[model samples]
Target: MPFKRPLLSSHTTDDSESQSDSSHGGPSKRRRVSSPRNIEKDKTVLVYILQAKIDPEMMSELAMLVENYKVERGNESLEGPTSVSELNLELTGDVEKADVIVTATNMRQRLERHVEWRIAKTKAIVTPLWLQDSVKSGRPVPYGSYIAVHHLEDETSRSHDTVQDASSGSPSNMPSEAEKQSCWQTEPTELIDTTEVELLSHTAKYSCLRPSPLVCPNQSLVKEIDVIRQGRNVEGEERSMLSYSRAISVIKAYPHVITKHNIRDLHELPFLGVKILSMIEEFLKTGQITEAQRMLADPRFQSLSAFITIHGIGPHTARRLYDLGLRTLEELERYYEVKPGVSDEETMPLLDAEASANTEAAGEQSIKIGLALRHDLGQTIPRDEVEEINGTIMRELGHIQKGCKSVIAGGYRRGKPQSNDVDIVITHTDWNLGSQKVKGLCRKLVQRLHEQGLVTHVMHLSGFHEHNVLRTHHWDSLEKALTVFVSRHNSSRQNVYRRVDLIFTAPEVFWTAVVGWTGSTMFERDLRLWAKQQKGMKFDSSGISRRHDSKLYHPRTERDVFKVLGLVYIHPTLRNADA
Candidate 1:
């Protein structure tokens, strides 16, 4: 739908048996004509899917791609509304007639099927460089069940013919003699360059959602990165082939897409997608992704990845262990399992198995938080940490519940070295089971922990800002909150000093607040942009409500919350400190 042309293809048949077949003129070929006016701006519908919701880089890529397509085709084509369902209805008054669903990775299976079975009669394109593998491998497009692939083969053949005729100082099949003498011909159909933008990537790449799934949000990039990574630890000749990794893969998937690439003269390679080409006649000046894939083969990162997989480790911990000359699970085992009689550390300090076991427990949970954040907050946290930085009264003072509904978030989630404190969110199943006794369970947990001394201190619950935030709160009574204090004792001679926050959440606001409180400040700000600026919805630390009507929208799960925001769901572990 980001295309400037209406008809997908136009072809000419050889005249050998045309008259005998009774076909209509054997389908005369034609070319697209340019218009000097803005075309896409006048469309009634637009469906814009975001691959990296909070990525400055990827969003910039998408905008450029859209604008460029307009300039090249000399037409303004509308995709559809931002919402997918609305685009499907074919409502007469709907301003969106086009469906431009975007994603950070490959098109998801469900959304693809939805478009395939139900929304078949529409236009859609899923961007993001990560989609190269899926699109090339014949996986369904995330936009819908079937793709309206713009046919450039016929155009290619036409262009070839036209060039051949011109080389001889004349177009052989001109409409008339006057047209034949013309030095210039009309615009020939060609394959419009597809857009491939990445939302953002600092040291780590983030999926559109904070952390939901293990797969990359951009399917193509994921596959390509995997292809590159898997090809690592190679022999002499294989290592030499590394430099051409990205370009070779991109060209392979789309041979004619890069009709030309002068790799030798290029310095840094950049992938502009369709946007830059609109502005510059030669956006793809070189046949490279532009940045020059230098760090494509990172043996160190792969090794760190291996080290962090141990039981009690996080990224930071693993990194430190690596620095200390212990780089893998095997090395750690070697150190701890030295011969029984060896005085290597007596000579070496004793390596107690139990101490390591406790660390392993922490590391195992850290992995969970990481996986949970894959789509919820796409970057991985340290080996034993979650990703966010919030510590409410309940989580900081929470009891080790058998089933108290617990999730660790914040710096602790990201596996930081000595966090100031831990943030935990809790709610009893019967928090609102139609009786005060049932609801009292939440408050009771705080009391039980306080009595047990796991909590060292407690902060009085603060009232809501008593000021405007998203214009949704009533009377400013602190958004219906609750908290409690507790203290913990240490076996050492020194007193312990750390605070924990345990928040009792109502069913209606549980998921939203759980995720909100579990986020990094930056990532949460991005969520705000999606809510207030993009989706016309309102999200607060307390709950998610409708923008126009101030209707409180209670999501049954975190996935639903992401769905309404027009984003892919991320998991916990991947949320990282950025979330």
Candidate 2:
């Protein structure tokens, strides 16, 4: 037999028919009063129950109460088994057919994964405590309304009242005839609705032109896109990865919700091509993108992704490993003949034994350093630890040189919860003292840090190289040092080695260096591209300059550099282009 949810009401009605004969004696008049039974009988609502946190015993009791509740009036009894047929109570998993769903807060996310809000017509009502209390009493008891529904209605009413007062006049306090006349006589003011369009139409063309943070409206969709991009990168598909990055960049900057309607004109959006549009269209039509789903399930992609997660292996190396049938870290270790206790000097031989050996001597040396710090490179430095390290470095530098300063850059500057490494740009008051090079200042700093026992190992060091003043270039020949530092959070004797990059710059280019390194890589890339293509200028970590002019445009601050490039200054936190 079909089941019906119990109806609770504040008042009961007479079950006997209250009919009066008409004067014409043709028919009887029936007065209609709002009653719980009448309301239940009027609409046959299908209800679905979700036992999120409810126990089995309580659920069984609630089900029984729903099945056998009596609806009584003054004299005649309406409490029969047939009355349960009024409601089609469904215990099946087909939530779409339901009109009302009873669930808890914890079950909402679980349900959302299966049924999207637009397609599922069911209205979810949080299970209220009063419902249980009334069910236990087994009477026609009026319980409190669902908090979720009640709060939504309350918010809607409040918003409506506020809008009505602002746009239209209040009903209780009407203006006098004279005041109305004066209002009509006064000049009218035009109110422009600026809030409707949240995104800046002009600046939305490029992702770098706008500010994007780690959280946004399209975060979930962006995450899927990023996953596919990473898979492509693992297969050494640079072109495909670039295409996916374009799609990701545009989606990150989009301020509106991504729906089928909004993305219908995908061609009009920048960097979104046909291939990406098709994926998006598929995702909108169905809940998933076929290509991404297939890629996720592919064993080759899985192997490559896992291999790429290692400290030094990049996409190309990961692909080689995949081709060699090396799927897991254990397999990789066995293939490379990596011993349990590999020393720093032996790291190079182990790397060379891998499938894709480094060809160039310089590249091999870099890989050796990377291999040496493999464990440290993989460990994440928390935000607090980064700050603590920054403080210690600054204090040490201050002691070494009177006016030396450092600014933390890279992922930490962009407000990441954790970072792979800490980047610091160092400059001094006397850096501009009529010299092309700082004469072993990098070595001096390393020596001081080593004496203080903070420097664990000097990985690689590059001295200053002066660029030919006549040529247009992309990057600078700057003094830099990459080293591993020993860091400890508490009084633990064991030390954690973390990667630290120190880029020493002249005071003249300090601001530009800060703007360059304090980056989400994509942001820096787009900024440089924009500078060259749009302004006919060249920009790099060194400084900005006109392509035809010899003089460098030195900006004293990051905001000043943005102004020179005719861009709206973006804060560090908003520079997360992948967001």
Candidate 3:
């Protein structure tokens, strides 16, 4: 069982009495000398819990379990009270007093920055399934050597060597060959400076796995890198752009502002290659990179960036527009009327014919409505207005389905002050049957919402065609409906049209959908990149799966997904790429 500690304050009544005794006892016996046995009896281990990334509920449960139980050694039954020296567990908030520091495996990556520093100060150990395993088996089983809390103070004090050398059927006794090469010893705890080191280590090599708020030290540096990355993207240099973005992410997660000294020390940092490092060095030295400045002045890049802002426009289409000398949204609108035909090898070659057919079939009124809706989607909504719309959605959804759930995703989920539009993912508790019924379920919900006058216009509706909801591969791909909503502002006495997307997911991929949709685009991009490039896994809105075997990985929660992918579970609020 887990050991319990007294809830008394750190300073006790006996300590004050000892001082008073010393003051009255004169010089001869004033110095109270403790024998080796007495000193040994008085020795106690101090521990500090790193609760930064730990779940509150789990932490509380662990603390309660520890408070209620006592540790027992081999062959000893947990029948009676154990001696104080046998296993005395005291949790301290003071890092200086802690002899051991406890943390979770999932938080290891985030804690990497502090590993060397913590190891110098205290014994840092990883205990996998800490609460569950300990509560189940009634004993602590350390997962790793460096961070293990296997033996209590009694057994540990008896003979340190025995406890250290004993085999406990772990993966291995000694460090693996791979780990051995990377291992380094620390200086004595007395010599270590806690003030100089960062406390919380990032849980993953990638910044996306850790929460990075807008107020990070390297925010300006990241912005500079992003401008260059955006230029790379505009020029169709995806590989180079990704490399730059990765470096930006690493810098953004860094705890302190970068200087020449610290920047040079970042050779070991993720994605900080020679080229990217040199670019950063150049920027730091001159306050800007010539290449980035040059790209900013380039007409092609300027045009492409603007063109891509149009609804339904992609890099390919933007590039095509740029080649045709379209430099602004106004220019694109003019060109659309002139040709109405734009195509590449992948796109429809009979684009003009298709446009004509679509117009003849749906009429000019439908085309005009589509254009107006697209224009509305491009407008940004204030945070207050966004909240009002969300409130209206909740009230409307509650009437549609009693137990319906809605998660506001996109930029809003990342804690953006404002959003271009609202993207909501809707799911019902009762609709957990499978993907087969998802299309119809979403159609029913959307139709009801439309009938209620909440959804003013349908821009794009997937899974349903020609008023028929079909169960096909296309419909099952993803059930989504994009519509314009009528948001009324009582203070302004106006009804504003705001674009809102309703994405539906089955019970199986509900969590996956929530995570995927709730993204700062770069966060999702880097997450997929890390999973594929680093872990040899595939991740998407659909689900996680092995690269080769195609076996699906079903995670019960969002944190479980991060664990499976070997990432730190970053909170939604800190996933903002803009910040």
Candidate 4:
């Protein structure tokens, strides 16, 4: 049984005296200081200040009051007065020694990494209010109401308690043997046909071979799993994130709604591991995953997700920013604020030398631009706007070089209602122009667009030579410009800033470029995987190349590329694998 704090005596007259003083129009009398008899003299308390919002001075004052009260007790031991020095007013990096930890932030957010181990050690983790109440009541307060419960801690404790109860021959919450066996033995009366299940099991292995629609019957379930996946991504769990992605792809391609009736069949699908299947089972039973819910509500996850949405920031950088305590875009902007006469060390004291150097090399300018246009860039681009933006680029390209054809790809090509950005693959049929000339196309077109007030900012430009023109062998190594485009809406009279990618490839590989740029990420990924594994060939935005001999095959059309790879041509509209 858990230890319970003793209740304060009801004979105490402090409350009545304070009320009498107030009613008589006199100054409220201060309550007399009393030593807390219930507190263990040697127990160590650590006050950890996590967030910037918490006042250190208040913690110090509270610690001083507690310490002074302990000293007033004059409790003597063999060495003399009992050590009032056991209490830590500041974070001392010795978490193991703390009997009680009072923190400002949520316990799950702060100590989630090792919460189970910490709980197993029997540490009483609570909020600052616990300490305040303990001091006010002249005794340590009951930890039941003040305990900061981490979700994982609760699960760990329940499992531990169940095991202990079973060993001790006490009534336990653990499922009975008969109940456990029934879960797997019980089958639904209406089941999917065995032949259909076999066919689905075979086809579901490769996402590229299947038609994944933008809208799926299991979208709600997929969304919850995806949130957990996103949380893993933010935490830099590469393998776990990929596993979740694979599971989500399989679920999205599933044509029917996921209910308990067909959940047993889901185990047949590729990438649906025991863990993922368990999550699906839990979701089917409760309509939500506990882990996903906790992650969705975590401030740290929210901040990291927001940071990675910026153009230049990746998971690693976003994690670093979170470590620096930057929670919002506004806070990030302030962190990068350049003040005159202040050194970098003074401006960003939290950043170490190595991090500072990495920041300078990591396109800080592009990140700042992303921050400035965060709202505009975050807005989804409708199909109409996507076409309009494509048209604007095409017009500008025609002026620079006639017969320059452009293909609008990305989510728009896959038939999504809205896209996050525009990807355009531009190529010319003039053989005389050569590879050298094609390399300069992106730079020239972007310059023309910038002059015309269409291209606002160039985030990145690559695959261009400065002095001597180099011959490019593959379409994947084509010249490209990542630019921000601004278009005016006539009705709203507002300038909408959009992200655009212009890929300039030679005419010979034009079809391959179109095939590469038109993608749902998993579709392209599996295409490459299948080509390498099954066909003994390498595939990319570039044309096909034989892996054995390294000879490139020029694809005349998008269908030709699929034909070369021995696959039936999947229409662009049906290429939404894990959309």
Q: What is the lDDT of candidate 3?
A: 0.55
Candidate 1 lDDT, 53-109, residue by residue in tens: 326655554445443443432321124333111011011112133333344333333
Q: Which 10-residue window of candidate 4 scores lowest in summed lDDT?
A: 179-188
By the TM-score metric, which is better: model 1 or model 3?
Answer: 3
Ten contiguous residues minimizing lDDT sum, candidate 3: 181-190
lDDT of 4 by residue, 1-579 (tens): 211221112222235334535764765322222332222223223333222234656656555665565445334322464332222122322444344556554435445554445452466565677666555544344343344443333343343343223222223333333222222211112222232223332245777777677888988888999999999999999999988988888887888888889888887788999999999899989999999999989999999999999888999999999999899888987787733222132212111122224445446756776777777788888988888888878887888787666778888888789899999887765544545557777777877887787877776766633321232432345777788888774358567778899888876566677888898778888889999999998888866788877677765456557768877656677667663
List of clashing residue pairs for candidate 3: 109-202, 109-203, 110-201, 110-202, 110-203, 111-201, 124-147, 125-147
Task: Identify the superior model by lDDT, candidate 1 or candidate 2.
Answer: 2
Model 2 pairs in collision: none
Model 2 TM-score, all chains together: 0.59
lDDT per model, in order? 0.37, 0.59, 0.55, 0.64
How do the residues 91-124 of candidate 2 rate in per-residue lDDT, one tens digit apiece? 3334555444455532324546655645333343
**Model 2 worst lDDT run, 10 consecutive residues:** 12-21
On lDDT, the candidate that comes out on top is 4
lDDT of 4 at 133: 59
Worst 10 residues of 1 by lDDT: 84-93
Model 4 CA lDDT for position 19: 55
What lDDT score is found at residue 158 in candidate 1? 41
